[model samples]
Target: MKEVRFFYAPEATITEELPQDEATHAIRVLRLQSGDEIFFMDGKGAFHRAEITLVTNKKCMYRIVETMQQEPTWRGHIHLAIAPTKMMDRVEWMVEKATEIGFDEISFLNCRFSERTKIRTDRIEKIVVSAVKQSHKAWKPIVNEMLDFKNFICQPREGRKFICHCYEEVSKEDFFSLISSVSQEESLHESDDITVLVGPEGDFSIDEVRMALDNGYESVTLGKSRLRTETAGLQAVSMSNLARRI
Candidate 1:
């Protein structure tokens, strides 16, 4: 299995020395020696194979020897617009797990029900990076800055739009049910991207849901259970992936 590779975010192409933490971890923690083969495929969808050429107590350098591109040319993209939980740790966990399950975008919406008004981009980015490596996924999820719910509803986008809001008397379809239906409409064996919104702990406000509905967003449901924000997002992702597989 080519020893599943590792990649540096900045592509090891800078003139300056590697960051202290990165250097130390690559050398001291992973313990690579000169002449050992490895790869640092940049996150920009390119792969580079190399052999360790320089080694210090701090960092080990690799000489690029081979290059290739792997699978998943994005005809599909999972964009999850979500409300950040009051507990930032839960938000972190959501980013990490969602990346592992293959998400393309993490959008933060400051809705009426939102408990946390701010999101730390750096911390969330770290979680995405760790998840990409942990899950052996070549693609990382893009975590966007927080935006107001009303503003998000006005943003223009192409293709099918879905809003998963649990509301009474609104036409709601189970996420799995919708996934199955959407999959059946197209080539299931191939990828198809869709965006989903997971509301806050207090859930999406009635006004927020109304605005989304008025703007042509179809209402969808995860299931009978009222899930926490993160759980609902993952459930939707998992359902989409499974449906695509079918």
Candidate 2:
């Protein structure tokens, strides 16, 4: 049996030709020819099955044969906002794994104790696209630009909000348990969104944690063991995903 290949085409339904990078891969790397079957994802909950109609040196055009809308793997939107690690590869790995596990969105946080103040979102976006294809996820997670910790917490947000920290002074609840309790509630809705904040390796400063708490963000813990920045972010996402499963 021939393997099925999926390509990321944000406007797959509107455009007959693949994007430049995807086109290059299909024509040069895959050597796909006319009449070859291919699949495309618009990253917006739909997949298009197509057959290559024309293949040129620079472009690969296809005719859509069928379009299918995919249901989300999990209920609600799970958003993770974290401070990027000094080593970018660690952050990249976390994003890839989280994408596979399933999540709605991710944002970078410039916390008070952030080791790295800046991030290359373009690179991270590429990695996310690759993961979406690899996982066969219908909806691509939205990547937001890095935001100051203060500004991010102050922004108006919907649904449940949480901050994961390790300050002994601040009373906290177990993240998984809190989410699970809510899941059992009769008020629980599938559209309910959850956003969790994860700090850097140095962790959010005491003052920063206080600010988040002041702004309607509940304090939560991801168990007892101390985790690295990337690990904590991935764990937060994993917990959120699991809660939805329950």
* Candidate topping lDDT: 2
Q: In candidate 1, residue 9 scores what lDDT?
A: 41
**Model 1, which residues run further than 4 Å from truth?**
2-5, 10-21, 56-60, 73-75, 183-191
Local accuracy of candidate 2 as per-residue lDDT tens digits, 1-246: 136678999989888999999999998999999999999889999989999999989999999999999977787889999999999999999999999999999999998889999999999999999998888888999999999999999998877899999999999999998877763455455446799999999999999999999999999999998899899999999989988853
Candidate 2: Cα lDDT at 217: 92
TM-score of 2: 0.96
- Report the Cα lDDT for residue 192, model 1: 71
Would you estimate the TM-scores of all the predictions? 0.86, 0.96
lDDT of each: 0.74, 0.92
lDDT value, residue 71 of candidate 2:
78
